[model samples]
Target chain A: MSNDNIIYPSVHSFSNLSLSDSSRTGFGYNPYKGPSSNAITPETSNILINKKTVSLTPTSFDSIYDRNILKKVPEISLSSFSFLFCEIVNWTRNNSKGIQDLEQRLNTLGYQIGQRFLELVKTRERIKYSKREIKILEILQFIHGAFWKSIFGKTANELEKSQDIENEYMIIDDIPLVSKFISVPKDYGNLSCSAFTAGIIEGALDSACFPATVTAHSVPKEGLPLRTVFLIKFDESLYTRENLRFN
Target chain B: MTLHSFYIFDRHCRCVYSREYTQGSDGGSTNRSNESDTAKLMFGMLYSLKNIASKLGDKEARNNLKSLSTGKFRLHLFETATGLRFVIVSDPAIDNLQSVLWELYSNYYVRNVAQNALSPVDFACDELLANPKFVSETDRFLSSLPVFR
Candidate 1:
């Protein structure tokens, strides 16, 4: 069982061929395309970019950013994240035309993060061999439990399906981390910073192939003034598919 | 103890990585399309097996199937939270296959492949296979396992 038996060619060989071609022509060559001419073998792994030599290596990128290298779950300071998030909200607020527009912008921003996170979280959970959540209820439980824990270090307080409507559901959180420091002025009128979180949920669900509309509502309780309820409204087609597949 | 092959499948049931060892056959004659067809069949079988296990298990228990054995070989499965499936086919006598799967996921797949920007999330990453460091490290890890001896 020697390594030689593995038939794949080295990526470095291709990289070397491109480097030689570029050096000989004294012009940048597209590495993706095959080498145009035989050229000098550069002494270093550096590549010329925009007329400046830039150091490059297979591992030049951050290894920590790699999901696998940091074996234990990574952590970021709450204070750091909070400050950064505050700046994002403030920036979004400054540019927004109105409250609705502000919320929409925040949602759009959160959506992309959510899409990437869905894959990241899913990749982390691959160890359990859990099947993809096909049922509406099952997927919600996943979001409320594993997904929530991954992001906030805690499970959601409650998950309730709306009794009046078949496709409506609610996930209640006592104090959403994103809005812990935010207080909406009276004029702001029902604005919840949790809207960002709602966008994240919406993005994750949308990418997972469960299209739904998610919105955050501020519903403060006696002691928990920052309480939030995320209302999820699934598309009618989701219900139709659920009925066809499960029933 | 003996290990035969390893496979990684993404959420979309696509084979993102596959490697065979100790099989003695070069498999050089097999084309890309044939390999893809084989992957599809394997994924379909695994999908059905998972669903069947879920339906047959007690409702309160975790539904994921861990491992199964036959007269010839055994199949070990480790599923990530995102629905990526890692399957290892090995000798029936092998022990602690789950740990091996964990090492492969955390050490090799996550570090060298997932973090690489050149490697796309949606397709099999041949660049990862071609990386000398990755291949060497994986070889070292697998060789250290008692089963490989």
Candidate 2:
């Protein structure tokens, strides 16, 4: 029953508090002194692809066979977060360049929250297992299980290591709550801020000093169509370590 | 007159500028529930501030407040459309006040400076007051600030 080796932090205890309580405490670190004078900027960073900034290719697969994975779990309503997210989307749309720009804006916003949440959650776990996640698989597994469960109250659908790719993995979530009530407008095209959630995963992973590239892809599994697969592509340095260990 | 007064008691941390200002009816108990909740959060902060200021002593505490601003210090509290705003100033620069006011309004607290030019929240004498709750709260907060001690 105990998966103590996992690197992600536990957020199950916050379950007792109401959503209102969570809202009051949302990303607001109220210290007696005051809010931090430092403001975090998310736009400065680049999304590295092939060790260089490049446009994401939706058709690219981490692994072909892994796409068939199935997950069995009942859906849950996270109404409070849904409302909060709607406002976040509304805010991002305020000065957005277009649909893609808006999605990027939302992704940037979520990135900081993700980085902060990981630090806070990791501190809660026991010291022996609480060390920062270093490897690609360990970090992906942490995101698929603990991070998803903490944020959405359920673990993700599946975590698969790509067979052909040197350092790639897929995290599938059957229902991303933000996408539940949302159908992107035609003008917006294929843009999705669930990609923001992927950015969060990347931010947390990178901040913990585990460098990786992450992007969100819409892959609806049978019977449940809102499935989102977060593809995490780790850098070559990661593979070098794995190879060294095996050799 | 030296105007030195100190009173020690526990449970809540509050000091009245004039003892007569301390009166509040325990009547119509429904309102008491709302007041009590606000008091619970505010009192802890006030108590901690008292504990901090007491350790600094009157001279050091007054100097600390004075250092924040160059002009005369005034304890100002404003009742906004929602919640309250508290500011302590010995001197006011238009720029400082503007930035603070901007932050206040943006934070959704509409500042209402009443005709009397006084705040709803009580502020005590800058002159030496030995009151234990006040001293304790002040001491508690000031000790934490490296700038003070």
Candidate 3:
């Protein structure tokens, strides 16, 4: 068995079955449907018999709404957060094998947070006509706009499609929020703390079914020394699939 | 209020960045010689002054020496928690440049020197910062300010 799809029995009503139905066999009952369409298979009497062993906690089945989900994000001290992030970088640096490995570790740390943040952002954003972003351009725009603002309090500086490559794009940010206070040592060659932010973009895209690889590069401008370019490379199969469906 | 020069000293009291706008600024754009010697003397003077200024105040509190002034020019000092010092030399008539130095630290130095992986955290003796991007950026930022001549 592949174990691809395992459907568990719905525990709706244990007290509804009578004591006479002990001779049941292939057991399946969905209470939502009418009695006319019910399978009425002779199920094992074990589930029907009220053993009174399992007690459903008040938080378990019925009350599924998360009260904190809709709550607004509270203000946090910037200095405290900066210090915390600085400590994390310092700690990670102590154990990392090399510059690239250190960046990779930082990116991995931010990946899960980005995945969850995307879902939460999407939930809170679209109140009325909520829809999943399937189109590539639409989702990228959404990320560049509301998603960026929600996290950094500002939208990305620039979003550009690569002229040379078919499935490459770039998002530029002047002074990424995470590495705002970070100063890399001279020995750590070309290691940007914004790798974490790149991972966030990657995680968000992957979770949204875009499936892209993302990396951050420090590309300083005349005045914008902290300017970083997040290069996103979409998987080849996505382009093929999009071409088939949308084109 | 003419901005004459800017200096950055690492925690070890070594001058890492020095930019003199008016050629020589010891007597309001009027003296030039050994650059490294001048930087050392400046750093030594500031180090002692900082110690004296902080000693006169409540000992427990981290009291920072804000500025020192003379008839010709003034030196405004801003030190980060990490012990990196930023000192700017300008006309004595100028007002408190604490906020200006803070802007330099946050918006300029931290962004360029700190964030640049290729930039060395530790400077070699007598070695000055040579990043063109950082140099141009600091110049661009200062030139736009009203005090910069």
Candidate 4:
């Protein structure tokens, strides 16, 4: 796993490899005559396939907006998604020894997703790059509204601070999409399937350098049944820093 | 044509919610016990049927069994990815109950029950049933259906 951190060569890096005369195949194609700068020129973009190299012009590719991101968001069938989630929960349950272990496993899975998703969302919104979230509240609001909307198709219902606790915060989702179809059996005690969502939030926060613990808690209401509250507790050091920097 | 009842079950085959719309008054405490027992039996049967259906085909390809008819009533089943099951019992000849189920799942279940932050893991089924807005909206939708008239 440690070796996985080593950066591998990109296709663009192949240009440097062919620069050396000894490594070159001497196939009449002059590797040195092209623009020597790092910018992607027509000559440098040529990719090698087998023994043959195909030169691709910049026009061969479509615009990034047209090819990569869609104008309209894609929709997923909710029923199909629910069944798949059910199986995931069941599979995790079978492999885990207890409810806590099962939750930890789910959290681990969601954590990886959260890390990747944060980067993707950040890059997609690069045009709006003004400042990184330095203030604690600013980042929490970003996660509560923008991040939640991007993933779940809606903003979280509520964001509030605990009346008594200084560092404690809460983000409430009227209905958590991940646990939409989940029904924990009575034997599981107080297991909230939204624990997976909590993990995702924790992962994103940790990646953003705000280190916190997030947990999902069920808070049943009169009409809304599957409502969940995600409790976020920041590290003591974060509070100390926030006071020193802001106050 | 009359809509009889609706049942909601979790993955564990426990009946989380049950409602009767058109049953005649058999006024007694025994009716409550009987209704509970019937709910248990109904869930057990559905569980077995799901198992049998999966065994009949490739396990991965076997989606939830959608509906079944017993000549007198038709049971329409909707299963979510997380294994929550919604079962509606109605007249045997009713058409477009699938749409009704979809409306119930999306408009009612997702909006009222699932979205309520105060809803517990058990789903606060009784609270959902008692909510006036939920009840009225559902009643309006059902009455608007041509079959209900």
Candidate 5:
């Protein structure tokens, strides 16, 4: 992070021939890059509350911003992240009024992650002269490809505009990573843990200035039990503004 | 080369952690408090300066305030996405300690404090980074650096 000359490592390197083959090539995926720089959270606010500064001393802590923004963080294990997510869900559930409130809280938690993730991933893209996503479809595709890949290590399975609804879109994941180990209890009726991922999508979209409401739903296929669909609903005025500005 | 001190601040502009490498004769309670006050003042100054610095650029000098220096010492600053700031005070002749500060943050700071589930996550507004392991490891790590002493 010190010097611009510092060479940042790239992802998906061919090294350390693991006995267990990872891909069809029979080689493990060894990225020269480090782990997720965003291992730590919980301090993030869903809303950008104006913090009245000028008091209190800094304790020894860090966040994934500034110099560390493009720096590849040590990868956070899925199990560990799941554990933390479980705890987050459990904690939010305590204060939630109902299933909706619980999901909302979970989404709130993912929102900040989304906002930060967008900037960090975009910077990491390091396109030399890449521009921001101005068009609606362009931004959505960016999210479905790069944004999802950065967070989940893979792109969303499908990015489809809603056939019935004008402003609605859907991003499908055959096997959602977050909810892989989680099972909603029988008593909880229809609680989906992917609300957190939905929140992340919403946060990233909103942060990118694409302002949308994203929610997660369980859409089971024949074999994929944990199949989740993220429903993204854009604001009514965005289409009008896009028409006026771009069209 | 001499590493004078180090400071960490969150987005709220609160100093989350600070350490001074005072050796021998530089000892006194009043001086210590004064040093802390100096840190607070330094934060305010840097915070405002960052805003100003971001604007003083044409096409690209913006948003890239890396270091500040005077005859006495050079201050290296690093900020994170979540708005955490890491500052290091070292000899003016030293090239830069931005890497060192980043190491401290990712290695000791994150592992010891931020990732520790039992420890407070919000080291910005609500909590202070008073973890014993974090402090001690940081002291060990900083003192061992070639720039120290």
Candidate 6:
């Protein structure tokens, strides 16, 4: 009561102000829309920014061969390289810690070489090689057709996907000829030169900028030839992004 | 002299044979038989060529061809790429010796040597000499030497 009687201008500045009328403009406003509808979703943001949107302009296969020039040296025997390769395998086996560890180490060794080989094979081919961002199917085809033919002197037996899993795919080779004469003793279960081949494929795919993981598995086919399967699996995110862009 | 066997100078070139026979009346059957005469003819023809090339410096290496008939061998000398010529003896005939000689020649041949030059042994040896273990051994050897004293 005593404060009220003092009536200070600083305390109560609106004491003398007169009331005024105001009107709201409803232009450009949707009254029925909820707050959630106006909010920017993560899904929408991803579509606008982070997705890899690329144009696939199909070019002819001639570009690959034009780049590969074969300069001939004197002929060398296959026997000349056999001992060297055998020692390389032996050396790798000696350094490996355990069986699985050895395989993993070998696989890692393969990864870099795979990258180099991809560039090499792309250039070396005379026909039906790819340069664009290739689909999984086309990559497997290129590996089966051109790459295998160049290295192993034949194509892979089968290219199939796992029935249960959408991302898993397999490249079945009837017999891995390099491992044909090789009998990896019980101690060196992890040692396999197939890792080298696996690395080659992985490198090629990575260089092409198609991200995928590849591993080699030995599956000896009965009566048929050259049996080994290289299982390739693409990351879920890779397929998802591809789906979103393509769809 | 009529020539029989000839040495190849290069991988592609052929043997030079002359039909001109020498006048040696040794009954064509004694030590101087038809085959022996032919071999002698080859030797005589090649020797002059070898001498000429040798005087020109070693342009091509000397390649010798040996011919064996009735366990007896004859020498035919010829210059290869180098002017140095070899007199081929019939002791170990050309066929058996050629392979060995070829392999030996190939090992030293510029290309094969170059191919193995970049191999791991060269790399490892260089690395080892640079390493402390090798350096320590070298130091010990040097310290124990009379030259150091």
TM-score winner among the candidates? Answer: 3
Off by over 4 Å in 1: A1-70, B1-149
Misplaced by over 4 Å in model 2 are: A1-77, B1-149
**TM-score (C-alpha) between model 2 and the true structure:** 0.42
- For model 6, give the TM-score of chain B: 0.23
Off by over 4 Å in 3: A1-67, A77-83, A86-94, A126-129, A157-164, A172-192, A218-228, A239-247, B1-149
TM-score of each: 0.47, 0.42, 0.57, 0.53, 0.47, 0.43
Give DockQ per model, in order: 0.01, 0.01, 0.17, 0.06, 0.01, 0.02
- As for TM-score, the candidate ahead, 3 or 6, is 3
Worst 10 residues of 6 chain B by lDDT: B12-21
Cα error, candidate 3, residue B113 (Å): 6.6
Taking chain A of model 4 alone, its TM-score versus the true chain A equals 0.72
Query: Which pairs clash in model 3?
Result: A24-A42, A25-A42, A183-B114
RMSD of each: 29.6, 24.7, 10.8, 13.8, 25.4, 24.4
Model 2's CAPRI class is: incorrect
The reply for model 6, stretches above 4 Å from the true place, is A1-76, A189-191, A224-226, B1-149
User: What tens digits encode model 5's per-residue C-alpha lDDT throughout A1-247?
Assistant: 2333232221221222222333331112232222222122343221112222233345445632324555567886765886687678778888899999999998988888888888888888968328987788989899899888888889999999999999999999999888765656456778898899998998888766667899999999899978999999998767976898787
lDDT of 3: 0.75
lDDT of each: 0.72, 0.49, 0.75, 0.70, 0.73, 0.49
> Candidate 3 at residue B119, lDDT?
57
Question: Over 4 Å off in model 5, which ranges?
Answer: A1-69, B1-149
Worst 10 residues of 4 chain B by lDDT: B26-35
* Chain B superposition TM-score per model: 0.79, 0.23, 0.86, 0.78, 0.84, 0.23
Recovered share of real interface contacts in candidate 5: 0.00
Tens digits of lDDT, candidate 4, B1-149: 36777777766556666666654453111113223777878778888988888888786786668888887988888888878888877888875477788888788877655543323445343332334345556666766778774
Cα displacement (angstroms), candidate 5, residue B96, comes to 64
Q: Point to the candidate with the largest DockQ.
A: 3
Query: For model 4, how does the per-residue alpha-carbon lDDT over A187-214 read when each residue is reduced to its tens digit?
Result: 6788888888988988888777677888
Per-residue C-alpha lDDT of model 6 across residues A1-247, encoded as one tens digit per residue: 3432222222111111112211121111121232333244675454335433342355578655465354432455654554555565667667877666655666776677766666666666635554544466777788878777766668877889899999988888777755543445444454556766676677666655456777887766578534678888876655865687577
Cα lDDT of model 3 by residue, B22-95, tens digit: 53443232112225687789889989988897888898998888899999999999999999999888899898
RMSD of 3: 10.8
